[model samples]
Target: MAPQLTSLYTTSFLIALFVTLLVAACLRAINILPGRTCHSAKAPRKAAPATRILIVLGSGGHTHEMFHLLRDLDTSRYTQRTYIVSGGDAFSAQRAVEFEQTLEDRASETRNKATTVRRRGTERPLCVGAEHFNIATIPRARKIHQSLLTTPFTSLVTLVSAFSPLFRSDRLHPNLPPTTPYEIAAQDLPDLIITNGPATGVIVVLAALIAKFFNLKGCSSRSKCRTIYVESFARVKTLSLSAKLLAGVVDRFLVQWEELEGEGGYVGGHAEYWGILV
Candidate 1:
């Protein structure tokens, strides 16, 4: 009697297992799987819209270097905007203006061409690389951590003057002292902010702080802008404490030549002599 009862229980368990499998197969056929097991035969989903991208460039060769990367950004996936912050004397303000203008012109031309093509009924898709790259110039503002006796009053005053111009975008009032650089940047916030190294680092820091404040106030999204430091002096094996700390905050870091790793160095856990620009 005991053997017979055990056999009956084993049969019931097997029947339950078979029923579960049958149900799963039926659900799959009907495309009603509860989880992610449903596999579509179509292509993968397209990337999210790149409505905004902020590119911050410091004075000197760094600006030129960052531009190279900016040029490569998949316009289909990004709307490139620019911010110019001079930290060093490598490029004069005039030169920076020229660079900024060149970028704007390129963006405009691309947009016009896309519109024209669409009007022509072309099959190619038009990618809006940068909806707007609002260019803002940020003057230098030194960061001074509060010490036992030192106050940040002076720094606060400096920032106020720098950011004051953000309020006056229509026209530089004749009264303002030639308009501080920070005022220009404050004119508008960005979706993503990118910065190169050396001079513009301070401006990047300030921009981040401002973004954080706006986010805390619930007006903007948490800092979606990314800062990219390319071929920075900090890339050297030894870096100042402050520089090291700054590196930690930057979103992505790129080095042209790795002296220790030499050409074909290992970066991003990938091996290549020449740094892949992406």
Candidate 2:
């Protein structure tokens, strides 16, 4: 009777512990998740001197659309750019390099014009070179023709790996003083994370949410890792699988078509139509 009572008490304690943990997780999700109208506050204010932006790129169409959206990116304000690509995607990595090259060329032309205007004063530096940008590679959460049973395991691995790039990595800025704006951007959390519909993108954003939930590296306290998810322009009436999963999780959910403006009503927030961002 004594042994049986002890076993029963152990079972009860285990059940109580599980319930407590479940409740705590629910409460945390409620506190940190963004609401329908709570979008503007998550963004960095104009007064910020330097901001780091992380861009998640996927293969093929997703990669093509992302660069188009960032065609007007201002290198002066967004001092540091981090491009996250999935493993084995050389095309996306190459595209990022080409994009930076274009920025460099544009900067050179602007500098030449500035020099012609006035040769005496020093011009503010442009963040276009290799030092100002980095490309990080993470494993794909789900691969083509992958087994469903193994997908969850792969995705779990991806979720864990995603945190490495979100936080500051000293390897990327070796021997540099932390006081400089570029180094500071490297040492701190990203101000913004931009993504389109990609499996890797969803995992990366999820990792950011997890970090914010625990206030990892002051992510939530400092209001960093704010995400903007743009639905693919190809989707006119319906949201893609990735968009459906992340509509509520991302800080801003943008859809190009009017029909998908309020698509995520079932979730906390709704899709915002910005009129063909891509």
Candidate 3:
């Protein structure tokens, strides 16, 4: 009886091994295995049609990282568009002109080397004015302070009135326009990628909501809509809790800080640790 039991166990082990080999062989035959996705596990897959990629970045090292990604994008599969909306020297009109020229030069070099011609350009995004304040201008600041001190309610009323047109919660509201940042960006874009800044993330979220509103599923207009958030812990750590919450809505989260690269703060579970861009 013992001999028979040992033989049975050996037979079961052999059968399981054969089944595993057979399943692996079948997967390899159909090119469903990881190594077979690309030819010989080393060669790259055939490039997909050009995708529309939007890089929404604040002006700083984060912006610099997006520029590097723009330069390296597989032109055969991606065309990059950039939107600048953050406040800094980089977001100023002068910097916008300089950055535009630099991006154009990079795009030209990329297009010359590949069959996929990239149609790239920059957009100066519209401001929501939610957090707009002018502290640098002393006269305006003094006036605002005087108003606040004299009549707090009046100041509050004035501020709300000033920003009334910018904030809309409902899609069907008559004041809200159907044309959103995503719709506007995706009009000529196949894929959209946004990086840095909570404001840019807001633009992407608005775009995705607009895409769903139009029912653009499965089409090119819907197919390439993707937002990649290039995150820096330095930046994330600096933001208020509400701003961090807002940043969580992006599609892909890529980290730049090497020491604190894993999922934390705003990124949560969907974060990818890319270490440093440079």
Q: How high is each candidate's TM-score?
A: 0.47, 0.89, 0.44
Ranking by lDDT: 2, 1, 3
Between prediction 2 and prediction 3, which has the larger TM-score?
2
lDDT of 3 by residue, 77-98 (tens): 3432334333343343344345
Query: Residues 85-148, candidate 1, lDDT per residue (tens digit)?
Result: 5334436444545655665566578778877674554332333322233345554544335463
Best of the two (1, 2) by lDDT: 2
Number of the candidate with higher lDDT, 2 or 3: 2
Which pairs of residues clash in candidate 2, taking residues 3 or more apart in a chain or in different chains? Answer: none
RMSD of each candidate?
Answer: 16.4, 3.6, 17.4
Pick by TM-score: 1 or 2, better one: 2
For residue 145, give model 1's deviation from the true position in Å: 20
RMSD of 2: 3.6
Q: Candidate 2 — worst ten consecutive residues by lDDT sum?
A: 40-49
RMSD of 3: 17.4
lDDT of 1: 0.45
Global lDDT of model 3:
0.42
lDDT on C-alpha atoms for all candidate structures? 0.45, 0.86, 0.42
